[model samples]
Target: MAILFRRVALVQLAPRLGDVEYNLNLIEHGVQRARAQSAELVVFPELAVTGYFLKDMVSTVALRIDGPEVARLASLSRGLELIVGAVEESEDYRFFNSALYFRDGELTYIHRKVYLPTYGLFDEARYLARGDRIRCFSSALGRTAILICEDLWHPSTAYIAALDGAVALVCPSSSPLRGISEGKDHDDNAAYWELLNAVYAQTFGVFVVYVNRVGFEDGVGFWGGSEIVSPVGNRLAKAKYYEEDFVVADLSLKEPRRQRVQAPLLRDENLDLTIRELQRIQRCRGTLGHQECGESHADCEGETDAGLEER
Candidate 1:
């Protein structure tokens, strides 16, 4: 018997800066429309509840994970799973860039953004605390992991999630349009994301669902090129750039299994060797040519360092 395919919707919207109520209403409307279209899962862009580019307003608009607003979002997720991003406030008052997963009117999982981009036009580390964990969770759509914006830029996050048995990786991004390509066809940022999504999907044999926001905020315009990549690195569906879009595509759960059977990269990974090599590299840090272990460079020649070549 063939596995049944599930419909998923990617909602690309431009949220009002610092206006939590308005953004929530937009999310509610998107969820309603996705449900009307019989979608089993709906994904929103990063910081969909509170618009991105909140320099100082991040603290002012940070919300508790169990607050009334989140409760309202959970309520809207009846019969369908929803993945949305927002500013999460901890009990100690520290804020984190987070993604919330809701299913059957309940909060299923929460993935806090681990990597906070602090360079260039980004200042996330100034306002948000970093998340220390990256793990996948069971969802209505199957085993999945959530990586917010810059978190997906780090290869280890996705690798770890795949190692932890994730079949789908959902990413919510608020990437701005900065550099244009030489051909003037697509923004360089969008092109990079396309390559990144395809590489991760193909290498890990997992579905990649990326949703990005659109519109201008504080002179920076977000490029909305939300897309879904199949386990074999096929671009299943993509939303239009610079516009609010509701894109849906059917994803086959059996694709990952088929791809993994053909590739088997994860099954062949050597985790023990990886961990040992990373430990050796961590111990090699030193100043003025002095090794931490007091060993000379010549002494390390015989050691098999688990570098990129090992993969």
Candidate 2:
């Protein structure tokens, strides 16, 4: 059998806060390094063009999809695939945390972060509008999807990508390190992320490429434990901790193909059942219960599964 493979590179770098030009230069250097390694694709950290934690300066470094900044990013693609995160400014004057996918020197796909975390140190909901669409597009390395930061935390995001026929899930994150682990030098969050990535990889039978940033911004530090996990839950490559590192890995299409034949999880997923349950759950909540139930709120609360089946 022929070995179907793609050499992938993950650049875990510290982006300069709110500096598009400087960050672009950093990305260019990464792309150059990737080309030297003969990588087919290079993935960068989230908001790589504009640093994270931009409260009111969201629009200051925002780039329109057709802008010169994006063109520069596109040019970096050249003969390879490039996934770079940036602040996208729409025509209606809204800014989004977006991942731009470039292949063969053209803009191919764009994924705007859907789940914007609002709690704790995250105030994204206050500064940016939420995205509603999640899609997988054609790429040099088969079908792929880019899920940014908090979007990967939601199981539905990865599920949708898997069902959409994505073989590779690329997640570009700007995650901040929370709570020190005494003498360990890394936080508890690292362990949680490793478990989460492995679960998604094995469960969905797809490769997981996670590229995270390093360095401190406004006193908060981001851990740079970037990694790539194979379809069978094996770590292909991992970057350095608390420092910038360029990680390279070989992703074989054979793994996903072999796993699907062994597991067939995605093939067996019941989409209709999931939709029905979601709609039923939606009707069981708040005003939806009173209106969508076609009966009294109390009656809806006391409804049985048999009654729902009849409806």
Model 2: how far is 267 from its true place, Å? 1.7
lDDT of 1 at 106: 94
Estimated TM-score per prediction? 0.93, 0.92
Compared with the true structure, all predictions reach lDDT values of 0.91, 0.90
Candidate with the greatest lDDT versus the true structure? 1
Local error of candidate 2 at residue 38 (angstroms): 0.6
Q: What ranges in model 2 sit over 4 Å off?
A: 182-185, 287-311
Top candidate on TM-score is: 1
lDDT tens per residue, model 1, 1-311: 97869899999999999999999999999999999999999999999999998988998888887789999999999999999999999999989999999998999788999999999999999989999999888875588999999999999999999999999999999999989767766698989999999999999999999999998998889889999999988899899988999999999889999999999999999999999877766665433155444555643442435465686
> Residue 186 in candidate 2 has what lDDT?
77
Q: Write the per-residue lDDT of candidate 2 for residues 1-311, one digit (tens) a residue.
A: 78988999999999999888899999999999999999999999999999899888898889998899999888889999999999899999988999999997899888999999999999998999888899999875678889998999999999999999998899999999887666776787776788899999999988999999999999999988999999998899999989999989988888888788889998899999999878876776666545554665642454565688999
Stretches off by above 4 angstroms in model 1 are 286-311
User: Model 2 reaches what TM-score against the true structure?
Assistant: 0.92
